[model samples]
Target: MTYAPMAVMQPTAHNRAAETPLPPHAQITYMERTSSELPVTEFFRIERPSFDPATGQARFFYRLNDLSFTETLQLPMGADAAMAVSPAFAKLLGLTGLVLGVSYFKLRAPFAIEAPEIALTDAERAFVIDVYENGLGEFYARNDLARFGKLSLVAPTDPVARQPALDLPDRTLLPIGGGKDSLVSVDLLTHTGVDFTPFAVNPKGPILTSVAAIGTAPLYVTRTLDPDMIRLGKEPGYYNGHVPSTAINSMIAALCALLYGYSQIVLSNERSASEGNVVFDGRETNHQYSKSLGFELLIADTLANATGGALKYFSLLRPYSEARIASLFTQSTKFDAVFSSCNRNFRLTGNDGPLWCGECPKCHFVFLIFAPFMKKERLLAIFGKNLLDEPKNEHSFRELAGLTGQKPWECVGEILEAAACFYTLTRHADWHEDAVVRAVKADLFAQYGEEKLQLAMAECLTDSRDHHIPPALAAKVAAYAV
Candidate 1:
């Protein structure tokens, strides 16, 4: 029934605003409760941060139920021409602050099923569904698939004041994740002469190396989760799992677009992300749910509502398949040495020793995707070793090729797409002799027959029209599509 004061992490020159009290953490407990007994008094708030130009830092705070969290973002000194920022942009940042809280809120899910959706409008509620239900669909299905179907969310009934539109510039804000798809996006934007600034959260070795490969500086934004969430995850009652990271990152990009006066926010998600890994309780659980077209539309519509249709957010590579993205990435050998899709290498602090661990699903899939596009020697040189050439990779490729087992719970292309890539390579002189490829090809041909392999290859070459790419950018993106 009480409130926890927002914790400020950094000292800044900007003055603090009055703190509005909200529900405390003790108000919600998980012990011995049925679905109907779930607490409804839970509240989440995004407190306005004070930005100190002297330190070039902005300190923001948020609360979920009773747990308080603080995140600080330090801007580069003298990056912009003006020191003054508009209030509308501050509100946009607050919206992003709310998103920051929601991402961490997943650590408390199922236990605290009810959120302050009453704080959101009808459109905002729909956006929240995409962010929570769909975005966290993988998290729920992984932890408790059965109970997930019974969960329902409530929306805010209170009216919100709409703000006037901002006079945004033509520049685009592109978010980079130190991968082939983002690097390909950078190439497309540069080729079209579109003004853009590469944006990232918690810049590390792989991200820095990838951005440096293209010869440009990036606008780095940092997000720090409360250490208590990690501690709480170890507790008996608190739930923990993956959150819709791309959804969270998109919100960060949206705020950056507003703060830097950019009208467009560009992402690098591919069309293959739309497919689900498995269906459970009448819902599809996709690891890349946040990157799907549905989430993209929700984000676009939500941003329009929040910012008066002045800001735009969508993926530049949404039309291209993973195979097509791999082909386009092969166009520029400049990034081959630095680009990595291995999720293992990416961390909050630093990349693991090797860029390619060559063990995980991502490493195996990246190897398969690049096999048909780049030469065997060049691909091996980039990965430090040929993944498909390794005899130990047969099982991994089996999952990728769908010759055996379910698709691994990783951000990979669908089973048929992987099969298509592997099948296509069997006909190519460069890859047919590799050990893993030979094993996968032999197994797939034996199980599904040669005709199915042929069909899989044909499907890989086709592009999906299910995207929200703007009319102006569609021509430019299509030029690079395979």
Candidate 2:
């Protein structure tokens, strides 16, 4: 459960020295039965290494055991591609990359789960692989092997057979963030006649404002991680880096569900959560590690084993795309002016900051998707500027059109939906004059062609319905398109 600091061994001409290693830790454990009642159990042992001067990387490895399946993950220090590692890691310890690749590889039998491909350049791939290999070794050294021994006894049991359902008050805990996804989730849950309280952790003004507008009871938690640990990171030390806020937030939701007797912890993550991060070491790891299906199943299994009852953690928005969710929000009276999916606005910084810095991929994608549903004038009122007018946004639009770059890291649907929305808007007279639309016409359709582009767009639109857009909202979507 604890790790000692490894002395920095300087790499010779061949072996590079790794940075200070953090205490060994277990990321998670799960014991569950498949729908077919096949018993499955797994645990992750994370060994994080000290920073390495040679590569200028922070590394960590995770060893996973699932009774039958074993996986070893080696993650290198810097983030490759656009998904930057957390700013906390950078500010505290000079961690680079906005997102880090958390690779998972089968160590035992080759488990055949289909994952998305890693999209990275050759140099980025080399850096990612190096970090991954070094990180894996550190995880092995730091983790406690003995704790895993207890997990063997835990097995998944049928929820209905184990205990009678609790007949407590019909209370629901609606998870709310400032994003459009969660707002859509809250609306759907409210429509379902569930009496609920809105839950948030360390939320800023924009999110709080949206939640307050919902008029639900608010439950908030003030998170305080050890500042000493953070300060230690500042002193040329090592850290696992900023785990996705969603991962930490999910853990908090699990605890809250357990303590408050809530039956379900509904997440707002979409199906695109499965899209892998940019590749390192010939593997496509999850950038939003905890949001992915693998992590969701792990957390659900853990909660079930601990409580021995029906406690659920599922994405209410799982089947939908960012576009469909935005479409639903635009059609809804509750969310039209208030909902925000922009990451920059969601930061601890105040709302007075740019509501939508149209440059980021998120802004570009959001603008693209919403353009089809809302007229130009109304859309500009909401976003404050015509995002489609910017030339940088035009390139991002073409990227979504499959003209440049691979799918972005945030969500695969972001790109897919943007492409679809672009195709849809081009068919309309209103959006034809829009400069970005014109660029997509000249740049994208010329290459991909209109027929192929339309087919792809239609496919994406069809795929959006399989997700958790409630019947009322789905109806609204249909009505809007009509």
Candidate 3:
């Protein structure tokens, strides 16, 4: 279906104050509740949700063995109008549980299943193994690679079942992450006049404001983690690190699309996500694998067969590099203040803290990416400080530029792209004077050289052919390509 371009709407005026302060590190407790003996899955089921329109709660319940997880999607409006409470919608919710169940199971590193599809087919088994092994690559590398390597899947005892695709609406469901990339997608999707809903998981603070800035009321869901997991992390043998959250959110978005009748589920992942930070256990370990084209294709195929060819899922910005994405983000100046790419802002526990923790690799890289597109004053205003001006942040920037260590396992661009950004900064008179930039100037020139730096910059500006975007969606995003 073709969507026409619509003029952008004015944002609703509101007081934008900083949230109550919380310790940046204090918020997230890496909670992994693993047993020496894997937690046996008695059965997995999604109960019928209890929706209270008056109070505005859409609660989803899931039970995996003895553990129970409840996810409440706090809607902006009443749930009564979202859709009728039907079995079809209930099944979609169930499927969402099935997808999220994988992550939950990984927490304990379960070994056996008791019921409700006790085993999976070779294909089904392979899909689960891929998502788990690759998605949980970071977790495995950090915690216990020996134990994680020993993990295995239980093959299906019966044939795999596929659900017929439900008849759904033509509108698209766009997952918003309150970052520059998603904002760039918002601009493109808006310009195309696509019937799209900006949706978010655990939306608060910046995300809500960003949706408002686009003049659209967001469809948001709050995800609450099991408190027990946090307590378990404190225990001595429990493993804890990062989970492939993008994979979890993608499934949730797909469920919402099916439940609400949207035909397409859109994301903002870029080409740079495909690059691996390091290799672990003879496998390429990428922190952003779930957001990569490979995972996109895997999930797309898996969901198509599972859902009987219903919804379409793809990243709108997959073809572009992070450098190209930053370039596109500059076209829309409204999000400069509200959107934040810092991972520190959205922790799993407690209230969120500052948007930018200037000490982290994310802070250093985003600063470098924006330096080429935005002026010095504008960039400083967004980040609250000049990252390059701080000698303290030099180590982090060095990691990003490949001047010293491997790419810090953060959702940063490729090393060469970081080099390209640094090279671009050298050409910018205001940026070259920064303390960190001045320090790294010689090393960058020696490693990448002037000629190679320009080539990397050119490569970054060009789009990649690797993507799973549908033809129509490709045509829409193509207009913004640098």
Best candidate (score: TM-score): 1
TM-score for each prediction?
Answer: 0.84, 0.61, 0.82
lDDT of 3 by residue, 1-482 (tens): 11121111110011111221211221222334355444354344434455555655556665656667776655444343444354344444544544555545555554442224334445555665676678888776666453345455443343645556657778888888888888888888887777788898888667877899988766777776666655655677555677788888887777666655677888899878876665455455678989877888877776665556777888888877788888888776798778887776677652366777777788788889989988778888888888898898888888788777566778988777788899988889889898988999999998768987887788777776667788876876676454
**In model 2, which regions exceed 4 Å deviation?**
1-170, 229-242, 348-351, 411-414, 463-482
Per residue, candidate 1 scores C-alpha lDDT tens digits across 435-463 of 98777666777765787667655655666
Q: What shift in Å separates residue 161 of candidate 3 from its native position after superposition?
A: 6.0
- Sorted by lDDT (best first), the order is 1, 3, 2
Q: What order do you get sorting by TM-score, best first?
A: 1, 3, 2
lDDT of each: 0.69, 0.48, 0.68
lDDT of 2 at 173: 64
Candidate 3's C-alpha runs over 4 A off are 1-95, 110-122, 147-149, 155-162, 349-354
Clashes of each: 4, 28, 3
Measured over all alpha carbons after superposition, the RMSD of each candidate to the real structure, in angstroms, is 11.3, 17.7, 10.3
**lDDT (tens digit, per residue) of candidate 2 on 308-398:** 4455666676655555566676766665566666777765335576566667777777777777777678788778888877766766666
For candidate 1, the per-residue lDDT at 467 reads: 72
Clashing pairs in 1: 25-66, 117-155, 117-156, 118-156
Q: Candidate 1's error at 68, in angstroms?
A: 3.2
